[model samples]
Target: MVSDFRKKKLLHLFNKFFDRDGSGSVDRKDFEQAAENISKLRGWKQGDAKYKETLDTLLKVWDGLQSVADANKDGEVTADEWVSMWEAYAKNPSSAYDWQNQYCKFIFQLEDASNDGAIDSEEFSTVYASFGLNKDEAVAAFQKMAKGKANVSWPEFQELWKEYFVTEDPNAPGNFIFGRSSF
Candidate 1:
């Protein structure tokens, strides 16, 4: 189970992702818009192969989240449902762990711009920039993960994500994955 502090931080990040319209709730349209923005960020031009691939992956993620959080099948995730979903995850952190593993897999595909099956420094920097990190901070974090390697493979990144989300160690390289968190 995550500590209270970490859980709060996770919840904050969850809300940030789900509450896309600033309307205090998440709907199907919000998911579509978020997917569109991510597709654009990945430089996917309309009708391109990667564009459909990336968009499909993102929509799958959205569907997964909706399956978990949309209790009423109303096509929207109300604030209450969102809180309930997190509360359930808090009680059973393994559920969150599994969800995060799938999330990371999707992110890996999206961030691996070169289709190399791994993330190089440049790709890692793109991810950091998306999270609002500066170049120096992103470089430092990537160096820590590199540990003499030129890239981070999927398994290595899974370990990093586990550490980042499941551990409280202040010095964990995964802590820097999301840039500087306000929490």
Candidate 2:
């Protein structure tokens, strides 16, 4: 049910994080490298209190995701595996539904935010970081979607937010957006 604009935006986000060569599709190495870079960037300083804090935060986030990701008897997660993992998480986000709701609600509450009801660059970075993506890679990924434009519409936000779960619908009617893949 995503509009073309939203789908493109989501894909653009994915491209920022996972398409190292600037190709549209994500490869395994690209995904791995980004994850590693994010970790390293946040945990670079050894013996610093901030490093420990970052490590603790990273571990906490990973631990929460691990139970859901340790599928198919593998200790390591590949790109497709991780994508599928998030896809499942998006479907039933009971673990942090209230948290996510409050986060989005807070974004909407910002005065001078915008009439479109979406958070802007600074707001998105702050909120997205608070959601566990506290690194440049994460910021870049979000920027790809936000595009520094003032306020994405509510429907656009909803559509892009739900993208981790929904596949593109290729059979869209006239004037409707369709999935990128074709039969």
Candidate 3:
């Protein structure tokens, strides 16, 4: 069973990402807008390699969310569907972990500006900031993940991602991944 704190966090994430239109639910247009925003933030243009990469990543994520959260086959995610999905995920952690693991790898690849297979604090900060983290919060999160080191590897990132989604501790390093937000 998911802890109350974890449940709240999951809802917060759902509301943050899926409820873009603030219409109390999420539809295809919201996902499309989000993808467009990401592409714009990355400064991706048509015919560019990075554009294709970013587009693919965004589409993958959008598809995943829609497939998993839109339980009624209505092409929309309601609050009930969102809650049901997380509850089901809580019962089967591995499925959630597998999806999140893949997502973390995608994020790592996007943030590793040098293509070094790891991300330094500065790169980490930039990525988190794009997700709404302030500069200081992003740095703190980086330090927490780095654990006195200079960079974070894929395995370590996977751990952090799991903790970020599953752990209830507000002060946990993973909690800082998305920066300071009211839970």
* Leading candidate by TM-score: 3
Select the stronger candidate by lDDT from 2 and 3. Answer: 3
lDDT (C-alpha) at residue 87 in model 3: 72
All candidates' lDDT scores?
Answer: 0.67, 0.43, 0.70
For candidate 3, the 10 contiguous residues with the lowest summed lDDT are 174-183
Candidate 2 regions exceeding 4 Å error are 1-44, 94-144, 147-183
Give the alpha carbon lDDT tens digit for every residue of 77-142 in model 3. Answer: 787787777777656566773445556677778778788888888887776677565767778767
State the weakest 10-residue window (summed lDDT) of model 2: 173-182
lDDT at position 46, candidate 1 = 71
Listed per model in order, the count of residue pairs whose N, CA or C atoms clash below 3 Å is: 0, 0, 0
* C-alpha lDDT of residue 53 in model 3: 72
Q: Rate residue 161 of model 1 by lDDT.
A: 66
Cα RMSD for candidates in order: 3.6, 9.8, 2.8
TM-scores of the models, in the order given: 0.72, 0.39, 0.79
Query: Residue by residue across 34-80, what tens digits does model 2's lDDT show?
Result: 44444454444546664455445444434444445547645444444
What TM-score does prediction 1 earn? 0.72
Which runs in model 3 stand beyond 4 Å of their true positions?
A: 97-101, 181-183
C-alpha lDDT (0 to 100) for residue 103 of candidate 3: 63
* List of clashing residue pairs for candidate 2: none
